[model samples]
Each structure stands twice: as C-alpha cells, then as structure tokens.
Target: MLTRLELAKDWVRDAGNFLKENISSPLEITEKTRYDDLVTNFDKEVQEQLVSNILHHFPEDKILAEEDDEKIKFDPEIPHLWILDPIDGTTNFIVQKDNFAIMLAYYEFGVGKFGLILDVMKDKLYWCDSHKAFCNQKELESKKMSLDKSLLGVNSYMYRTNSGGLLDLSHQTLGVRIIGSAGISYGQLLEGKILGYFSNLQPWDYAAGSIIAEKIGFVTLTTSGEKPRFNCREQVFTAPAYLVSEIQKYIKS
Candidate 1:
C-alpha cells in the first residue's frame, strides 16, 4: 500500500513520462483569450489523466485543476485537497518544445503538505515537504541574494504592456527574464540561479512552487505582500523576501 505522499510523487513522475513521450509529436493547438495564452490536446489529456488517477485513488479529496471550467469547491473543513496544473507553460510547450512543467501540490485545510514541480525537458523534479526542498533528490537551500545580484522573471506580455504594476518592478531588478513559464522560473529560484520571479500568475503556476520555496526557507507571497490563498481566482506575483520589499518600493515610486 502506498502512502499519500508516495502516490502523489508517483503520479507526477508518471505524468512527466507521459508528456515526454508525446511532446515531440505534432500538437493540436488553439488560442485561449489570445495567441499568447495557448492550450493543446496534450494539456487536456494530461489534466484528465491526473484528475482521474487522483479521484480514483482518493475519492474523498477535492481537486482544483486548470483544465476544468467549474471549480471544485471544497469545504475548508475537509482535511485534504489537491491542486494541479497539468502543464504550467502551455505557450512554451506549444512554441519551444521545452521549459514547461507539470505542477502539483497537496494541502490540508489550506496548509501545504507536499509539492512537486517537474521540469519535463530537463527531467528534473523539484519536490519538497515541510522539512526541506530537493531537486532530483538533492537537498536545496535558499541562498541570500540582493537586488543588484538578482535575476527576475516576468512574462513578456506583462513587461511589454506594463500590465498589473510590472514595469516599475522590472526596472528595479538587476535583470529581467521573460521566461514565459512560471514553473521554469520557480525552478530557477530554487536552484539559486535567480533571486526572484514575479508575474500575473494563476494558482496552478504558483501553488506547488510557492510551497516548496517556503519549505526551503525562502519567502513566497504576492506582490501585494499577502500570503497566497489556495484555489484563488485572482492573479498573483511571487518572489524572495528581499525582492518583494524592493519591488514594493519600486511600485510605490
């Protein structure tokens, strides 16, 4: 019998394998809202697979997945719930064929228990619990980095359009990276390659990574400095502590 954590990890690995096998093939793509926001057959397939697997194994738990139109409302009284993003960087998956991820997180009454962010191309899995974070089984620790030494992640659309208070924050960082995928940017933050990442992101983009970041002793929050609310419909920005404060100042100025 597998524990819940074991089951979650296995599901992620299986999903990643499924993605790798299919990623190179021709994908049927369609635009959602705009050309920059994309969805593919593979994305829906993966989401369906994950949802079915989880529901089959844990029927009592609630699920919040990106592909579904109707949100699965959970009673806060329920002890367990799962949040999933079948493919975090759908546009990247459609365009570049790399730099995308399968993101998952489990929470207990709004308290995060475990998180998994699998970088499909690199075949690296970033996972963590309350104790620590690991990349491919190697323990990871948060490193201190200042604004001038930092590399920040912002979406190209946000940077170009100056949407949602992003332009001022972009200018303050040492350098800005329009990575197109929040999952990839989150990996960069965990590996110490980047100091911060901020953008108007959805719950799927930030839930798993934010839990991992917090576990490893890094600060994770919205640009407004509020802790993220799980199953939220609002857009959010996440980053390390120093950058959050710095960017807040920049936005004010």
Candidate 2:
C-alpha cells in the first residue's frame, strides 16, 4: 500500500506538471452541460496520462473517471478502484490559468485506502495515506475549532437557495471563498486555511478529499446530516463537525 501510495503521488505530480506546461497552448473548450460547466482537450489528455501511469504499476485496478470512456471499467471482483477528476476546475484552468487541481483516490474493497489532490498552480500536493493527511511534508491536525471562528469555503449558489440555510450560515463565518475546485477547496480545509467546505460535489469531486478529511477527523456528510458514501455521483459536504451541525440547523431537507 505504501509503495502504491508513493507512486500515486509521483504520478499525479507528473500529470500536474503536464497541465502546467500546456496552460499557454492554444486550446478548445466545450460545455459538458452548460457554459459554466466546461471541459478542455487538456482535461482529456491529462486523464489519459494519469490512467496510463496508474495502469503501468497496477493494471488490474478498476478506474472511475469524470471523462467517462469505454476504455475504463468497473469490476467488483477487483479489490482496488481508482476515482479520478483529471482537472477539477476547468474554468479556472482556462480563464485564470490557476486555482485548478488534479484529484485521484484509490479504494480497497469500497473503502478509500489513499487519496491525492494536487493544486497545480501553486505546486501544493495534499494527500492522505493509511494514517495521516498532509500538505506536502506537514501533517494536518484534526478539526478542532468553532464554526464561526474558522474560515469557510462555500459555493456561491448556496445563497440562492433559502431552504438550505447555507446562506445564513455564511454570514456567521469568518468569511466564505469559492475556489472552483472541490479538490483544492478541501485541500484548504486540510491546511486549516478554511474551517469547512459547503458545496454540492459528485464522488470524483469529493472522494479523494474525503479520504483526507476522514483521516483528519473532518466530517463529510449530506447537508441534511447523513453519512456520505464514495465512488458514486451525489451531493456531499465535507467540513468540521460543528459547522455541519450549524448548517444543518437551517437545512430543511
């Protein structure tokens, strides 16, 4: 597990470097569902590299990736599964040329064994192994602070819905930030940069981050307060325990 985890880290870093090199290249962008939800050719290219790297070391592992293609498969008989979001913030990558991330999580029999999320622009790599969560060489501390006192990361759309009460909770925090990438947003949580993350994200978006969050004792749950399951597309919230409770106080669902 240690060897595979180390190799996963190296593979992702190399992938990030690939994205960095192509940032300035003339490119094409298309909307998957809407203009706000974008994908670039580089996204597909980087994912191919990631898959190739993983398969080189562990070809038997199943792969679940955002760019869904016939080439990857899910075989329950296989003990290892890798979930990937080759580029977590495509808009940021295309528009700002920064604040994007690469996320990958490896699971063993449905349980996340290790995860890695790299902030490509800043060269920050956040990962979780069997025992700990870290930003580079620094081990992260478990969640331990008041919700209102902690910096918060939230999706701005939460303010559009009155029933969730996320809008109200935002007012109670030190501040709210929307970094566009769930992987990067959760990385901030790992470093204590944000006290919590309140966003609607799918499994690939949150699975890797969840592995790190769980290790650090951070809570990953539904806004209505439910256990979050990985390897499936669903809405999820990863945050401190207190902040979750605070948000749930107003969440009608």
Top lDDT model:
2
> Global lDDT of each model?
0.80, 0.81
TM-score of each: 0.91, 0.91
Candidate 2 ranges beyond 4 A from true positions: 69-78, 229-233
What does the lDDT read for residue 242 in candidate 2? 55
| TM-score of predicted structure 2 | 0.91
lDDT of 1 by residue, 205-248 (tens): 88898889887666666655676565564446666665566667
Position 42, candidate 2: lDDT: 91
**Where does candidate 1 clash, by residue pair?**
none
